[model samples]
Target: MLAVESRFTGASGLDAMGAAVADALVPQRLQTPDPHRFTASVTSVDLGSVQLVRASAPPMRSVRPVGSPARPDGAAFLLLGRGARGEIAGGGVSAPVDPDHLVLIPGDAAFEVTYPERVEVVFVALDAPGALRLGLAVSGPLRGLALPAAGRALLAPALDAVQAAAAAATPADVADLAEVVEGALGVAVRAAAEPVADPRAAVRAAALRLVDRHLRDPDLGPGWLAACLHLSPSTLHRAFRAGEETVAAMVRRRRVEAVARDLTGPAPGPGVSELAARYGFAGGSHLATAFRARYALSPAEYRARHGSAHHLRRS
Candidate 1:
């Protein structure tokens, strides 16, 4: 579930607003030419595995100096731009934040962003492992440079969902929703990187990497891949046609194989239902049917025959 932890409807003074910002976001130095004239509203939410901070304010400068405490483990800040134009400098590089683009600022080091006009920005703090599980890590802090329009379009709905859910008292299955956003963020980051050569083999290779990384994502399929790679659906299909299996088949087969490995691993960990959800199965029954088809054994039977717990008992 997701819940709103704190909210500042309107804080007249910069100090008051700063206090709210620090409590929700990381501690930082906030300044403006006329502190008295400043007006702002901020809201912070705890989404179980993620944190979201939204701030609306007039022109200002915010800084997190060197030697500041590193962000909590697995945390990466995604600044989604909205009506804000500014410059962000971090790790000895600076980039502009315009309305058309998004910025990823990993909090493991120092960073700063200055906006010269009225600005509204949504900052999402997500787990690094969550993103890596979906096959993405931002190479470094990125801003200023324009991301592909198609990539930006793909990310819009995920961010919109988060903002819309902020008003609800408690949204169901929020962790899953958070992971979806993380996957979308990764796809956007990859899309923003240097373009790959447009060859059938290259497209197939790149698509394979994406498929392997996002096997656990329910949304990992042809439509999503086409958007991520900035190719038409027909073109994407043609690229994979000569392969052993279609993209859809690959996703299903890979997910089932991943679940089977988990079931038989030396560590007796997540149960059937948990594994099902983790690997993108609709439910335990769905996973059971798929597992039986692949290995000729129900998940429980497979575990009893080959799992770590079974081995331990035998020993």
Candidate 2:
């Protein structure tokens, strides 16, 4: 877990925390009835596929949810901890969550969470797609779900262990935390949603995760992805067929997109040949050809147009 703690105070604190909140967690607008009295703080631990975030303030009003266009990418599950009364309204549903409750806040829906007084909440952040894999009822609002006594017995301690290990985690421990979380949450998600199971969606997400993590491995292929995901190659291909792209195609697209970002960024990033080899391309020409197909500009041309301004600034 990569721990990041940010705090703000005084007259301008809430505004500053808003920008920081947008970057670290979600892109949303925040307001407080009284700015001078509002102090906001958030601490996040990046645990790969999921993140753990603790957010607190005197009182707040927020708009634009994580899955909304204003701020999209991840979904949130909030477990209220202390000192607040709140209402969340989204996707034509309204629910009140007390300190003893938990709620799944869908990523794509525009919603508002209002707090009346000083309060703190723990959020387990999941990639919007992974939420689907876990069979979360994400099409709309899902609230007031708590673990059964037995389920809570299994979950609460696992999370507490993770939190205790968060501040002093080594790289290997952090890498393993995602697997630990996915396994534990997989059980919890199933216990909560008992009827619906999308094995294809789960397998598809696993393949995507493998591709993202092993992009630098030159021999990444369907076989490799299958092995890592504990599925046969045929099963892997079958699972991915439900999506728009085939397995190989998706891997290629992600690699090309990554190289394009590096080339088009402000800093004097790696050269084309280096970028190609680093991202599992055969060479610079291989990367240039694919980049052109995707962006309509060769790597060199794209770099010249987007990155030269930064070079000039540096000079």
Candidate 3:
């Protein structure tokens, strides 16, 4: 089980408040004062809840904490709103952040955050295993970078989910919120890996990952995929090309392969239509067109030819 708490109060000394929040947020802590008058608070938790510390500081002129030790236990993702400008200095590179941008910092690295004006910022801390499972660096120092378009699309929803979860008071709601936070972390890590300019490729990659994660969904068509990847119809098609495949073809191929793999076992699998729809085929007939083209046999025939041998081995 994971735990989370939130704190909000006026600042006596902004530096002290910042330091307190930083200590509560990460093991390695630092803070600085800016010229603006602001109201700030730290919210969420680190235990599978997509820990976030957010602050809205006063405008014009900012200060940043410098030269903190690296945190080796977890990774961090930072989101800066449009009213803020800042840079992170670490790992032999200085990464800058614009409004609505995100930066990911791997665990086991040291860095500093700076702001030039009163800005709203959010920092998410993810556990080591969660970070690695999401294809982010497991260990080593990391610098910050901007969240690309595809990333922004994916993260914005997740962020909202986490924020809502953090505010939930009921135990059951908190548990459900934890799940949402975990999902948000997954989305964040995947988004961090996306290329900046070519959001189409990112969308395709994200869609493929989603399909791989939820292969059992019967209605996982291009429309569903497009919504999940935050792309339009034409945009999703372009992304498929960027990923070196057509969307419809890719869905058909993935469905067929999933069914084939399922058949290559001892257990009686779902029927042809069931398996076909599970992988997003429009219908049995549509599945047949592609399945026969790829395997030179209808779904039932192919299953009959290959299923027995594989089932026998398993048995």
Better of 1 and 2 by TM-score: 2
lDDT of 3: 0.58
Q: lDDT of all predictions, in order shown? A: 0.69, 0.69, 0.58
lDDT per residue (tens digit) for residues 190-275 in model 2: 55554443667666765676687678898898998776655679988998898788998889998998887777776667877888
Q: What's each prediction's TM-score?
A: 0.55, 0.59, 0.49
Misplaced by over 4 Å in model 3 are 1-11, 27-39, 45-49, 59-82, 191-315
**Candidate 3 residue lDDT tens string, 210-231:** 6766677766778987665445
- For residues 104-211, write the lDDT of model 1, one tens digit per residue: 666565788899998888777765444333343433554443568866787767766775675673566566667766777667766777332235555665566677
What TM value does model 1 have? Answer: 0.55
C-alpha lDDT (0 to 100) for residue 201 of candidate 1: 53
Whole-model lDDT, candidate 1? 0.69
**Which stretches of model 2 miss by more than 4 angstroms?**
65-67, 70-83, 128-133, 140-144, 151-157, 193-195, 201-233, 240-315
Q: Candidate 2: what lDDT?
A: 0.69
